[model samples]
Target: MSKIVMFDMDGTLLDLSFDDFIWNECLPERHAKIHQLPLSESKEKLYQFYQSHRHTLVWYSSTYWTKTVGVDVLKLQQEFQSKIQARSGCIELLQQLKEQGYICWLVTNADRASLRLKLDNIAIEHFFDVIISSEQVGYAKEDINFWQELQRLHPFNPDETIFIDDTATVLKTAEKFGIQHLFNISQPSSLKDIKQHQDLEFKTLDRLTELLSILNEIDRKDNDVKIA
Candidate 1:
């Protein structure tokens, strides 16, 4: 069996702009109908509410829907799922990796609820062998406990568990946790404007069709190899 590779969804595979589109357009378009508010007002309220809780568990998963959205949780999730999904080539990317004999898992900082919504919308929920969420462990990617929990669940040699993300902070933390391979999205860093330790990076994932080639280049190189 090929080694396991972990993927970060939002800024890594899913188009980043799709986030703004969903929160700003698709979601509010549905929300306004349910709440009987003006579309503009609903959009503004949702945006403001999200800004305050973007990094929390409530924002990431169904907790927010059950407690705050005032509707059937599953129904609201189905509604949201109908809105945004993975970007073009997302399924193809995973399929290609699977065909290449790699075990692919979605490792994200997103709360379970939010992540499930996105995955269901894409209808590729089965692509991952596991969906690791920081919410379950009570620590975001910034904390190594999340990684420790993941390691306990599925032990992968650090030199083998590849992490692809768009955030430099998580990239650094993953590196520290001993994940040997880390690739920053070939785009502007979304989490923070910071330098990275990895030499391999991408600009924009217009064609993750290139991943196969990149994987071959991993060289199974030892951890001592520094960023070129």
Candidate 2:
């Protein structure tokens, strides 16, 4: 079986503080200034607008939001580049996964511009065997059709692959595509409490070593049975 491991970028590998800062703080502040409304009112209004297209591809498009919100999101992100960083222990986890012979791919809903910015900021781009953006695939990860297209372009057996993501909605879509090994990152943002989910969740990337050990043992036993 192909030991392919797919990772989500924003929350899984990178700290989500940057995104939270943009959506919850920067954009809202900009909206308040542009519309001459109170900050709180602008925040509420923009948040409602954000929710209206939460699961769609447009939600992840930096350019789309920039136009819609009448703000330069990409420029704002650059201004707050200090907030873009990898989650603690993520680099170690990626190294361990590579040493264990797993093919690691970064699969994210982030648009190309955002992806490039974050990757450059963290300098962890070389860690991934391939980085795939949902924008390139013409679908959001929340759609099963996106997974189908992903598999078509970069083939892997869903049963043999493991996918780790912070978003429950995207995980559900991956499950619908019959991905057997799934994990949820309970703590996507350090500022927030661990997000509850029905599936097994990891609080940090440090648990990755143990998780891979268990998978390796299971694979060993299965191999032994086949030999016998």
Best by lDDT: 2
Q: What is the TM-score of each candidate against the true structure?
A: 0.69, 0.91
In model 2, state the lDDT of residue 73: 88
Q: For residue 58, what is the lDDT in candidate 2?
A: 95
RMSD of 2: 2.3
Clashes of each: 7, 0
Clashing pairs in 2: none
Evaluated at residue 196, the lDDT of candidate 2 is: 52
Candidate 1, residues 175-221, lDDT tens digits: the string is 88988777776643232343433554433333556666777777444
Question: Which consecutive 10 residues in model 1 have the weakest lDDT in total?
Answer: 188-197
Clash count, candidate 2? 0
